[model samples]
Target chain A: MANLTAALTALPAFLMVSLLLLAAVAYLFRDWERTVAIIAGVYTSGLAFWFWRMDLSQPTQMLLGRPIQLVAPLTVGDFTFQVQTLNAPVIALGLAMGAAAFLLAARASQGHTFVPLGLTLLAGYSALFMAAEGPLAPTLLTPLFLIGLSAVSAFILQAGRVGRVAGPLRLLIPPILAFPFILVATWYIDQIALNPQDNQPAQMAALFIAFGYLLLLAPTPLHSAQTSSAETAPPVALTLATLLYQLAVLYMLFRTISAFPFVVQDAPLASWLEWAGLATAVWGGIAAFGAVHAGRLWGYSALHDWGVILMVLATAGARSLPLALFLLGLRTISMFTAAAGLSVLEQQTGGLSAASLRGAASRLPWNSAAFLLGGLGLVGFPLSAGFPGHWAAFQIVAETDWRQAAVVLIASGGAIFSYIRLARILFGPLANRSLLRERPLSAAMAAAILLISVSLALAPQLLDGPVSYILSAFNG
Target chain B: MEQLFAGLDFFATETGVLIIMAVIGLMILTWDWRVALAGLVVVQTGVAAMGVARTGLPAQWAGVQVAVMLIAAAMLAISAVQTPTSRSLRQAGNWPLRTLAVVLIYLAWRTIDVTIPVPGIAPDMAGLFTWLGLAMLLMLGLSDNPLFSVVALLLWFIPAQVAVAGIVPHPSIFALIGGLELLVTLTASYLILVDRLPAAARRPVMTDVVFPDQEPKDWGVTDDAEEVVDALPLPGFVQDMVDSGRAARRSQPPALPAPNSAAPALPLPPGGSENGETISEQTAAKEQG
Candidate 1:
């Protein structure tokens, strides 16, 4: 058991090797979708359990009054991977989402490409979260992430049959533009590290880093690629591109901010983030309300959720940090479930427009239910997965400024209206009745996902232990 | 090495090379494939000259720059040639727009200060780097053609690489940058090829239809027959003759041929004889008969 713990301590190395192995296996067994799915499922779930065990060790140590380290840091060639309190939950949520996405792909029969791409994305996110804070780390990891992202985009373009050069160009250009800023930030941060007294460059570097993240995250004005992707890309590919990629970039941004605390203390810089976040949220909600396409609606809702998360981070208060992390976790689960359900619905209907989906509930009841549940959760409705995190964020904001809270409420209300409108369209009179029948495996899997969301909503206490540990790290 | 560079100071100075680079960059903005390829080679020469001046490396190092440029240029030329001629060449006759873009790019570059300076690089060289980078970005924004965009992207990397070389000066980093540049160039070539393939040969890319059930019709048209005839691009005389012939045939009733009779042959047009007779000769022959 002790040896097992020691071996697992080299999590980064293991994860990278596992990524290569899974990709090879997937390629070699491309003809057998079931085998690839099983391999991906075991790997992702194993990583998630490993994170859970690491998170559990702190409580066990405190209760037993002994220094019990379940996971230790591994260092190799100036790179280190330590299971910190903050990243454990983040990594766990990401792996869990990967697991669910892979399972959905398998059940839905979304082709052999999903397993390899999903594993590659999982590895990228894990490495991103595990990257230590230093000049070399950001500089090295930024390019690595861009290369991985480019590969994923290429695959998605190939699988989705997206013939337009614009889609792939849009995906590739932003990272290229963002890379220079990250490199500049790295140089400045290194300068600061060398001479601790130079604080000006640190602040400047933070702003640059924030800008790079904004480009990666695709806030309101820069969000066309994501929406186009959602419309054209396959469900599994869309999930990887938008939900998984967004979460990884957000965590990377968080790590950057945590490394340089002074950047948050800069008043004008933080205020800019606040304003940008607010504007993006309001705009995204309005755009979502006006969207007739189901995929665009999902894209806008994701944008709105990210806007709120950014606002929470912009507050730069210790209290808001944990709330941000909590909301991120909840949003991931809900978004994955929602996106998976949409993918299934799209496959069954051959389209996702309101007209095509009219009265779809009578045909794909499980998918419709999952979509509705996921949408409602994103809107922060009661008994939905996003309720606790969003409610907490509201309370925290209201104590400081009522106006920001009001804006948040309006965005939530707009999202709720959009979801309700979608529900009406989905359950209304049958538009083009067909003989298509839902697959039992996919239906059951989607229902299980919905059940998980409902359970998370009904009992938010399930996240208490992890959230507390994350918060404790911030305090220390 | 310094003495050698001094001997060629007319074109090797920072300001002199920048002027040459700017000219090549503007030529690229014209979006002509042949001209752009030539301009890119010039741009690479400028880069190598500036690199030698800044780093004081031996003249042999310039071979690396020329080699990379030749490889990249070869790839671009192949992609351009394979592309249909109708799509490959475009003329940017809108001089005002081009002029405005250049002015704006220059101003933007001028306004930006290189806060982190490389020890050996002068202020003018840094400014030139900024100018080159912005110009590439402008070119990328203005063009939608994959080949042109790829060229612009490749150009954008050179300025950044040159600037970083002055700062880092490490061979491994240079090697890494070189490899990355090669990868990007190859990838861009692949994208161009994929873009040019026939729709059926390409992978399926699903597009959402705006109106699925509506039958396509010409709006505000009452006479469908006349509209179809009017849409044909034949000469007026030819169309008139065709219409008259069709009407005459449709109006006449078919006569039944006798059981043992051969079908009557129709007369050919004046110049339509099998033996290549001229219209004038046929007319004279008819008159003689």
Candidate 2:
């Protein structure tokens, strides 16, 4: 038991090494889909089982009877990795989505790059979550994360259609620009930590950190790269990169912002976040509403959801934090389902433009259902998983300011209208009756994903326990 | 000899190096490719010299810095060689905008007060740091070409590193920054190569340039190409229309063609080859006639 606990301390390293090995194997045996699937299945299931045990067990009793500490920090040189209350659920969710993506890719003959790149992304996220706990995390891990993202972008570009350079190049910019800001912030924070009297640099550092994160999130004005990629890149790659990577960045942002209470409590920064979030939400919704490309609609919708989450965080109240985290989790599920479904539809229809998707529902009913259902969930429809989280966030924000509530409602309305527009395009008349049907296995996977989303939506309580655990950790 | 040594040391000072860097940045903004490339090398050498003098690091570290700079320069040179002649010759902008930016930036830099004290750096040096940082940002903001943007990004890190060197003076950080410079340059080179590929092999341009109608004159079609297009044979009614279109075009010129004029050719349906070949023959015949 002690040995197991000790092994757990090196878990990030283990995961990274294993994923890299698996990537090598997958690359070498690109033709062996079953082998890749088996490797991915084993890794994801192991991660799920580990997360389950970590979540269910007491911190002291997590590793058998050895009285192991789940939140024990593992230091390797200058960096630290730990499975804490805040990140356990996030890690679990990331792994689950990764596993789902791997399976979907395997079924769709995209296992070669998807499994390797997806696993690498998961490993990067794991390290990012762990590293984000400390102030120096950005200095040490930001480059590593960016490099990993660059690799994924490169892989996607290579696999995608010719002349599709813009998407990957766009993905590269935020990280490249972010590196220096984070470095400067790290230096400032270190100075402040060393000399408590120095508060002047703290403000500048905080602003840099916020701007760096904003770039990382790629919210509206800076969102072209993500939107371009979403419109052009393969659906599976888009799902993995956008959902998992963005979630990690969000989590990191929360950690960094929370580290500097001075920054969080400052009225100007908080207000800035609020206004930015609202603007991003409204802008994204309107953009999504007008998007001609179905893939880009998914991107814009995801952007809108991120804005909502950001607004919730901007409230900076304890109650809103959990709600924001919950919404983020919901977003992960909805985006994966939406992107996966869109990928399948894109495969069958050869494009995801509004014209291409017109009447697609008649041809690919299950995929269309997944896409619409996912979009509805994302928009916080009554029965969707997003409803409870968004509702709680609105209630919290509304208590403080009604105008913010009005903005939220308007944004949500725009999103709903956009989703409806997409639904109309998807469910219009039968344009191509002779369309090839999706394989039963692929359809089954899509159905299973849709089922999970619907179930989570219908029973939002499923997230309550995890959310509470995370909140308790934050409070502690 | 002592006076000469003292003067050389003066150029290596924080203020002197920053001034030199600013001048190089200006050169980058206004100069042609060959001169700009030379300016970049000078900028790097000045930066390395500052690192040595400011940090009191061993002179070998300066050599390492110069080596990294050479590698970066080599990458830019390769990319410039590979880039199409038109794009390679593409200026950052006209002299007027460049001059306005320079004057504005210089005035702003000279007047602005920097309150946040970067540890170990003198107040004047800190101001220089802030100025160079803003200058790098301006360079990035003004340029759309990937090559110039990457160069701006590479230069952006130097001022910060110089400011920090006097404070922390860590070897690893410098090494990391050096590695990052190399990584960024390599990535930029890759993007240039990718950008220069035949349109059929490249990704679709994703930029939604607002004033596409305001494209630069260098990108304008040559009169010879227009004459060639006008000479292309057309059916009787189409020929009459083409003549009218030519007259209209002469009055109000067309916007620059898409970045890759060859893109439209690649997507022709497989069965349309005969029709395409026949049209090509007719155009050829018309030109010969």
Q: Considering every candidate listed, which one attains the maximal TM-score? A: 2
* Chain A superposition TM-score per model: 0.85, 0.86
Q: Write the per-residue lDDT of candidate 2 for residues A332-393, one digit (tens) a residue.
A: 78887887688789888878877778888877888888887777677677877677777777
**Cα deviation of A388, candidate 2, in Å:** 2.8
By summed lDDT, the worst window of 10 consecutive residues in model 2 chain B runs over B199-208
Residue lDDT tens for model 1, A1-476: 98655554455656666786887778788778767887787778877877766654553232134343434565644456656666776777778777777766775655567777677777766766766642255533465366446646555544535234544545656665565555556566667778888777777777766666666666666665665566656666666666666666666655666666655564255676677777777777787778777877887777777778777877756677778878877887778778778888887787888877888887888888887787667767788898888788778767768798788788778877888898999888877677376778778888898988988998988877866755554443
Clashing residue pairs in candidate 1, if any? A161-B205
Cα deviation of B71 in candidate 2 (Å)?
2.8
Winning candidate number (DockQ):
2
Tell me how each candidate scores on DockQ against the true complex: 0.13, 0.16
Candidate 1: deviation at residue A384, Å? 3.5
- Per-residue error for A387 in candidate 1, Å, reads 3.7
DockQ of 1: 0.13
